[model samples]
Target: MAGDKELAGFILFLSQFPFLQAAKILTISFIGGSHYLLMDEISRILHDNGHQVRMFRQFGDGMLPGRQAQQSPYPVSTYSLGEKYLAEYKALFTEAQKDNLMGRDSLQNFLIFLNELSHQCNVTLHQSDILNFLKEEKYDLAVIDGFNPCCFLAAEKLGVPYIAMFPGTFMNAAKVGVTGPLSYVPIFQSLLTDRMDFLGRLKNTFMYLGSHIVDKKMDALFQKVIDEHFPLGSRPSIADLHLRAELWIYNIDFSIEFPRPLLPNIQCIGALLAKPAKPVTQELEDFIAESGDSGFIVVTLGSMISSLPLVEFLKEMIDGFAKIPQKVIWRYKRSEWPQGVNVAHNVRLMDWVPQNDLLGHPKARLLVTHGGLNSLMEAVYHGVPVVGIPLFGDQYENMVRVKAKNMGTFIPPDEMKAEKFASTIREVVENGCYKTSAMKQSVILRSRPFPPDQQLLGWVEHIIQSGGGGHLRPYSYQQPWYQQFLLDVILFLSACVAAIIYLILRVIRALIYFISNRKQKQN
Candidate 1:
């Protein structure tokens, strides 16, 4: 009787807290750089939450700098193609860079990159061993890299419901039934903000339509892989498969992104990597401390491109840094520095810097970046102003947000001069309004009802416990294109109006004829 009472007391104590059930989750990633980091962070979050998590990473070339030697805490299954594919992958970036330098259209190179991804997908699917292993695991859920369509195909093959974690803005939000009114909501890559002039809206309209065309071309590339791998009758269109995802988690925050409508199944968990700053190394701390009231600046062009391609551009940047009073810590390869160029007295170049740590430091004043989303979010997280030097891709678009928010400004690469670059940097740093805006954004982000981690964890668990996100999904995805956009209804209304107008005209004509005939007969 005493033992039973003790057990009942213990159970009662446990009932005070919410109970959580552990889940088995598999994270699929085939690309590297920021994409890898995002997926890796997701897996870590799940694992830390007492879930059974495993990572399946397929090796691609161009791993993020400083992450090459880092190891994961959870179990990881890694696969790699031969050196030939690696060499080819590296060469593609070089060719694309050259195209950009020569002012040639680089869209062709981007398409080639998509084709390469498709090829990699095709090769990976044929690996019987990997397939068997994944099947044997029998994961309860899959978290996929949304940027890579191959990850979606892999999840489909495994017959598991998956969540897509997109590392960029939801440019394809329409695919999942989110409304993006072109009149206000700027199309991705268009670089326009929520507020636009007439001309801006007109340009946005064209880009909005062009986006769909580009998506179709991209889908066609991936469709080839599906055709060869899946049975003919069972093949699903890439768009359909995307629509079927349990949820779409975008790496964006309203603090940095323009205000836009979102559906229940889509969530924004931007800056997943942002956290409390850890203390920097003793050597770095000493350097930052020496900056005194001026405060040090963090400079990095993201992980992909460490060095400028043109010597003149490099010299301009160096000369610009020379003019600044505040010390600069730039992430540039020492070997890539021109032999004759003099190093700035206030600048320090290192192969890598603990970016988040430096940004979070009390003495940190500014960030000089390439306008990558990850870097932008980190800057927002730490309340640091920016001077963006956009290289390519969505970098330009990302900078637009920076300028719109009044947190910083950007310099076009082609138009960059030492005086212009230095003046822009100084203006942002010396101006109190820029820093105030950045800090305000940081406060808004941090003061949200649910922090990013909690949001991710709670929603993921909700989906798992609820079996799927079908309850949250809207029926819009199932509607035909015309019906979804109300085009059919619009056409029907137009036809009805036309019929009514025609009938009114005919009645008027008859009335006039009858009056004229009556008058003639009376005469």
Candidate 2:
């Protein structure tokens, strides 16, 4: 790792600059897709901070929250993932889903494809495009998601500080010596198992290792790309490429995800959504009020997990809704259900419902969710118990945390039997434990008086004023390969070999002398 690039980023120092003048903060944030609502919240926070924010969002054609529709986030932007890219990425995801890469072995293969694709976007194609744009229209700072290292590449080349922010409970950042909450999820411990079984633990260990491999491979791929583009007689090493920024902003509150060792570079502003938007509709309230004795349940899956994909399974959910006495308000894709399933007088389904609003309603009882971070936060915010039906990726682990907190039940999609699903929802709604747990979480969320948006702004300003994060920039000694320590083992073995050789030589000389003495005696 000689001549490796120093990763930029440290705690944003707040003291030096005059507070009178406005600062320009150019932001680029997208990790594969804009389907994540969490990005919107981050965008919102930056805008509230009075920073001039420019964005680059992928996978969606819609206008960014702060910008005009005519001129989008990027310099020359096309929301379309070209037909060839689409066909290939779809094929890859399809194969992964079919193979159930969540199982052992195939997981690494799936991860490699994902990382390579992400690298192509962040490092190769997207990185230079943004840099050229920045060169013409320069901005002070860039903030983006941590996993998307390519965005940071441009920031490094431009000599600007960029912050890498992780959305949810990501594990490897801690292992990489970054400050954050590592997913404390037990290995493969799904809905039924309290802890990970043997195969599950093995799978977890491999995934943990696999992520690092993916990171290494990503760095290699980016380095190759950079070398190809510039070819500057000699190239910058890949480590020289992936550096941390002047500051790190974690969109999480310490009150909830607690016990983290605070690092100056890493800032937590998670509770920005604590003063959430008010419910837009009042008609939705009338329906909830009607669900009298038993109360109502809310069903919602996050943005990425499509309601279209689960349409068939939803038929069974419709059937389950008929059996329960409590009313159900499902945030669905289509405005109406198929003809026959609409028979239940207790159920009201809409293509879209204001979810947080419905959950806050007094009649709201239990929640059926896909367990995305936003939904998780809302549920915790309202103190509503969840029956999580995790679809993919981090959802399973997110739900596991919910259950551990005594605030939810989880049923993996594979194990979602119709009767079992309904029964579990009924048990959670009727029983006292789930609600009690939700109330407890709600208290924790509400206990903190201050909103996090201001704190986020303060930190960003700190970075600008500090002349790059000098405080958080680590000294060089922290770098080492995992096997480098094993070199001592090599030295110890070499010493043993040398000792054996010395003994052999001594014995040979001694025997030669003894023979000479015997010969002399004979003479």
Candidate 3:
């Protein structure tokens, strides 16, 4: 009798708080590095909020062993790509780094990377065992990594509603019926800001048109995967799958990104990783205490590039650090250090540093980074100025925003002389305005109505409680391309005006002829 009463009470309590109902969530993480980190963080948030979350990780050949081996609180299942494919994926990054080091264009590398992703997608779908396991789980929702189209395919196969977590700004917003004006809004990699001159707008327009060509190419690459796995007649295009996402959680904020139109289902939670600083270790604290009035600078070139043996670049950077009075804490692998280069007296090189903690410290004067969005957002959160050395991909574009915001400036590899690099660092550190601007951005980011984690949790629960994002989805997604752009309406209006002008001309000609005939008859 007591047990029956307890059960009845539990049921009554659940009825009062619908959100307390736990959801079974499946997250797909195909990429490693910071991409994997973001997915892991999301999983942690959901798991802590009474949701049963599972991570399905896909490992490639060159992924760090540490990353693959790291344990998660929730259940995790992993799939490894074929040795040959992963090897190629790893080699591509190395080659791209070489090109960037030499100041050459690495556009070809991106194309190759996309091709590898398609092949990996093919390999993943062939795993019937994995697919069956996922299907058996019967998850209520899927959180997919937007970078990989294959994740979307997995979700579609399971027939579960999904949300895409884009790790950067939504460059492919148009794929989901959200459009940005080419005039003011810069395209993904154009490296142009929101404010542009006439020439800049012209360049942005061309890039905007060119992006479609790239999108079509990407679609074609993945179409083969879709055709083989999905039924021939019912196979949905990649764009169609993207449009079906219930929500898009972009790792971007207007505090860093320029103001642009957003859909109701799209949310920005860029500072997901930002939080209060924890105390540093005894050794690190001792180093900071030694610096005294001259605070230290935190330097990291991201995970991938930090392992490369760029002797020339490292030499220049070492010399630059020697010139600055501030102590330097750089994230570089000691094993990969060039043999002849002498280490700077005040510089400390470690395989890894507590980047966020260091940046949040009171003595942190500046951040020297590769301009990754993760690092930039951390810098913004901590109100630390930056001196960026953009290596590849979106790093260049990210740095453009940093400079535009007046938080800091960047030095290209071609211009990376030791003197120039040192001067750039000093400029940012000495200029109070840069620090002021960074603090202002930090305030703006922190002053949002809801913290990033809260926003993420609340919105995710809302979608689950409401049974998908149908109510939030806009009608523009279902419209034809011409209709979405109003080109058909414009064509119709143009035809009507043309017909009216033609009819008026005919009437005028008739009147002229009648008047001429009357005058002739009178004569």
Q: Over the stretch 184-252, how does candidate 1's per-residue lDDT look in tens digits?
A: 999877889999999999999998778888888988998778988899899988899889999999999
Per-candidate TM-scores read 0.93, 0.74, 0.94
Runs of candidate 2 exceeding 4 Å displacement: 1-17, 31-36, 59-79, 83-116, 119-131, 157-159, 178-211, 217-243, 253-262, 310-312, 335-346, 476-478, 482-523
Candidate 1 Cα outliers beyond 4 Å, as residue runs: 1-20, 98-106, 335-338
lDDT of 3 by residue, 305-406 (tens): 556556787788899899999999988777777787899999988877788999999999999988888889999999999998887778888899999999
Per-residue lDDT tens digits for candidate 2, residues 138-224, read: 667777666555565555555566766666654435333553222433332223223556676566566655566655665665655
Worst 10 residues of 2 by lDDT: 60-69
Whole-model Cα lDDT of every candidate shown, in order: 0.86, 0.61, 0.86
Off by over 4 Å in 3: 1-17, 60-69, 82-85
Q: What TM-score quantifies how close candidate 1 is to the native fold? A: 0.93
Tell me how many residue pairs clash in candidate 1: 0
Tell me how far the alpha carbon of residue 132 in candidate 3 is from the true structure, in angstroms, after superposition: 0.8
Per-candidate clashes come to 0, 12, 0
